[model samples]
Target: MHRFFISPQNIKENTVCIDQEEARHIEKVLRLTTGDIVVCFDGTGREYQVRLEGRENGILTGEIIHTGLRESEPALKLYLAQGIAKGEKMDTIIQKSVEIGVTAIYPVSCERSVVRLAGDKTEKKVHRWQTIAREACKQCRRNLIPEVMPVMNFTSLLEKIGDKPAIMLYENEDTNSLKALLQGEQFTGAKEIFILIGPEGGFSDSEVLAASRQGIVTASLGPRILRTETAGLVAASIILYEYGDLG
Candidate 1:
């Protein structure tokens, strides 16, 4: 069944109404009509099996046949605090990260970052990335949509990281590897794990130290260095696999 994420306000009693963009897609593109069944989620860890009842004035209403909790989400809450990359690299990162089950994404502005977003431009880009995340979730069958946060500077990003278990991926680090760290410790019941990846030029020594002061452990992705976009995806996948979500 096709799945879509809708707001809770659209759902009430035994009926759910899909408006605006989703309604247009169903009526004009998919051509799904009355009696067709589709699965819809509200991003609150619940999905409803609804049967289309009618469409009028660009609004599609369906009768809720069943409602249940979503089980596909991983037990581990994975958060990605990635340095903003240039062009399509950021888009690819957000899309793939959501597919791998990241809980949320923070676009951090690092010293080496080439793309700098500010004012209205930053808001527009964030909106675009969020749309990409939503589309990716639909394609990947994810019940919850990952949030693409407003871009944050290196120092500002650190303040919000708090004391959670975090790993900052730095190429210079040779002693601690993500694999080695996970293999030795138990993270099965950990509520959240933060993964930070630098931009094209990677993080400077000073930036690494700043993150370290905030209780984030600096780690490497092994001997071979991965690109800014590839690093975070690989890290998230590895963490998910280690925690048994990939199996």
Candidate 2:
């Protein structure tokens, strides 16, 4: 069965109305006709198996055959505070992180960040990242779509985190490895975890120091310096494996 995304409002008592690009794909591209069985997921953790019905005004409506909750979501609510990198780096981080079960992503602007955005450009970038996150959920068979939050400065992100259990991945930090951080008592039975990863230039000394003082443990992936995109994904994967639902 083909899978499509339908908003919750489009779904009535027993019908799902699909429109826009999805409808075009189903009609012209795939040539799925009436009676075709397809799957639809609303970003709100529910999925429905729909039997195709007649179309109306270029919109595809289907009869709901079965409905259930998607259990693919990880129990841990992992949030990524990623320093905005240049161009596609931010997009890749958002897409891959969502696929790996990140609960939400915050694009932070650090002192060392290469690319900066404001006003209309910032809104546009965030919208694109959020779309990428939704597509990633579809590709990875995840029921929930993680949000790409508005871009904020380094200090603002810390204020949002507000004493929550979080970690900052610093390349200069040689003392505490990420492996040992999760094994420690601080993360035991932790339901929510936040990770901070720097941009292309990495974090400044002052940024790392402030985060550490605010109770965000500073940790490293290894000796080699990974790109900004790689660091967040690596740390997220490890955290999920240790404390979340990943193997």
Candidate 3:
């Protein structure tokens, strides 16, 4: 059965409404007719198997035959504070991060960041990244859609973490490795995590110091350096695996 995302507002009383792009995909692209069965999720950890009843005013309505909770969420709440890269890189990072079970993504604007989005452009790009996240969730069979937060500056990101356990990936950090830091006492039974990765040029010395002073631990991903897009994904996976949530 095909899977579709229905907004919670569109779902009510054993009935689901598929409107906008989803309706078009079912009607024009898939050509799924009445009585055809499909699965729909509302991004709130619930999934429904629905039988397509009919279409009215370009919206597809279905009778939900089954509803249940999905166990696709990770036990740990992993947050990614990524320095916004270029268009394709950011898109890839968001899509793959969702697949790897990242809880949320915060796009940060760093001093070294090449791509700068503001005003309507920033809003539109955030919307696009969120869409990518949703599609990735659908592809990965995840019930919860990871949120792509608005772009924040380095300073703002520090304030956002707020007493939460966090790690800032710094290339200059030679004393502490990711494995050592993760295995240490700081992360034991931590319910939430925040991992920060820099942009193409990486973070400046000042920015790293600022983050460290805010109680974000600075750690290195071995000796080899990865690109902006690759760093966050690798760190997120490692963190999930360390928590026994991934293989």
> What clash count goes with each model?
0, 0, 0
Per-residue CA lDDT of candidate 1, range 111-142, in tens? Answer: 99998888999999999999999889888888
TM-score (all chains, Cα) for each model: 0.94, 0.97, 0.97
- Quality of model 1 by C-alpha lDDT: 0.88
Mark the regions of model 2 whose C-alpha exceeds 4 Å error after superposition: none
The residue-by-residue lDDT of candidate 2 on 1-247, one tens digit each, is: 6788888999989988997788889888999989999999999999999999968786779999999997998888999999999978888999999988999999998998889799999999999998899888888888788989999999999899998999999888899999898889998888899999998998898998889889999998999999998999999999999874788
C-alpha lDDT of all candidate models, in order:
0.88, 0.90, 0.92
Deviation from truth (RMSD, Å), model 1: 1.6
C-alpha positional error of residue 164 in candidate 1 after TM-score superposition, expressed in Å: 1.3
Error of 3 at 37 (Å): 1.0
Better of 1 and 2 by lDDT: 2
lDDT of 3 by residue, 110-169 (tens): 999999889999999999999999899888999899999999999999999988999998
